[model samples]
Target: MNKAWEGDQHNLKPLVQLLHFGYHQAMSCIFPVAIFGTLALSSVIQIPFLYRYDAILLILLAVQYLMYRSGLETRDEIKVICIFHVIGLVLEMYKVWMGSWSYPEPGYTKLFGVPLYSGFMYASVASFMCQIWRRLRMDMTGWPGFVSSVLLGGAIYINFFTHHFIPDFRWWLTALVFIVFRKTWIIYRVRITTYRMPLTLAFIIVGFFIWTAENIATFFNGWKYPDQHDSWQLVSFSKISSWFLLVIISVIIVAQLKYVKANRR
Candidate 1:
């Protein structure tokens, strides 16, 4: 029996490799899955003693700590996530003030109508990109230089706020992204094979999925547009463009750490 088991071990190699590949991809989703699961749970359960918003914030913080202690998240990744949290919080404060959206529920953890936990959503997005990049050993070819990318990202971030007051330059910014990243290729590995995609296309695809998730979140009372105060509606398709631009900002932030690591190596 032992001899037979040893003989069959070679036959199991492919299956083992496949499982290993899947595990890495699944690990990349841990942060996002935690966020979405909490969102789902919060929607249905209302505790008598605790606000759902504050509870979820605690839950997410616990999850984040566990990820770090378990080594599921690296220190550099946490640094990036923290920056993303602050960025998201700043945007939330401004957007709420602008009446772009509102959190209808009351919670002690909220300031200026934005729950502290809301920042985790943006951090989760950054976590996803960071984890996937590390797991797949991704690399970008034909990337615009750091200075150019940073300036472009700053413009996109600024435009998000300024558009409400001034003429929207989003279309021009979208064009700029194309011109900068048109030749860029995202190289990633799945199992033993490496595959590549256009960076621009990836932005659009990820943006579409985020827009879908936004609709689900709004339906579950995560936040509401002014129109949705009466009744829920699908998030506008136009928001996908905004998300697409946001993804660019995230990628640039993650890439800073990645490039630094590469240079060190």
Candidate 2:
């Protein structure tokens, strides 16, 4: 038991703590939730003149500005999210061209057959990570050195594109990820007690939730897998591995940024 709960009187401390954890988790998800809501609402509602994709892009821009003005996200965090937006958009364009998945809707805010708002799906993941890192006061221990981590991240990203032409090296890279991060741990606080989890486990957990969200996103017609073109179906469970790897890249970028920011202080 955590020392923070030692003073429990009614034996409800465990339940209370669980609720508190859930509350903070929800708070950390504001951006993704907003994106999901927009996807769901736009699916059924017909805008007078604007295309659904363009409307979603406009709404998300407003949401981003409001989040900044309301102090829900800091300027640095927003910059990180924007960096992820570009990274995700580029991947999206390439993947779509390769016929991995597609945006079936017509929109003025499209480039290379991809809707501009599609990038926000990736940005929302970074938004969740940044929000949770701050909310829980997260810290890392046993992280790999900067150069090594960057090289691994770069390899993981390039493999995503090159794997189409060459033999897939994802499994080999996954092995390297575990080797590199074997000793890493992430410490976070809930109430007055601190807890630590293996960094790789944390990546798996976030990856699973993102996979769940991917199913919902597909249900709402956010994008379509080739198999889902005729009718909606659950995203392949195998994609969890992909999300797991992508989560690693996201964490590495955010972690490096946080490291640099802290050192400058």
Best by TM-score: 2
**lDDT over C-alpha atoms for residue 164 of model 1:** 96
Q: List candidate 2 stretches off by more than 4 Å.
A: 1-10
Compose the digit string of candidate 2's lDDT tens values, residues 1-265.
6665665644786787788889989998999999999999999997889999999999999999999999999999999999999999999999999999999899999999999999999999999999999999999999997998999999999999999999999999999999999999999988998999999999899999999999999999999999999999999998998999999999999999999999999
Q: What value of lDDT does candidate 2 attain over all alpha carbons?
A: 0.94
What is the Cα-based lDDT of residue 172 in candidate 2? 97
TM-score for candidate 1, residues paired by index: 0.90
Leading candidate by lDDT: 2
Estimate, for each residue in 1-42, the C-alpha lDDT of model 1 and write its tens digit.
998998799788778777877798679879988988888889
In candidate 1, which residue pairs get closer than 3 Å at backbone N, Cα or C atoms, i.e. clash?
A: none
Please identify model 1 stretches exceeding 4 Å from their true place: 1-23
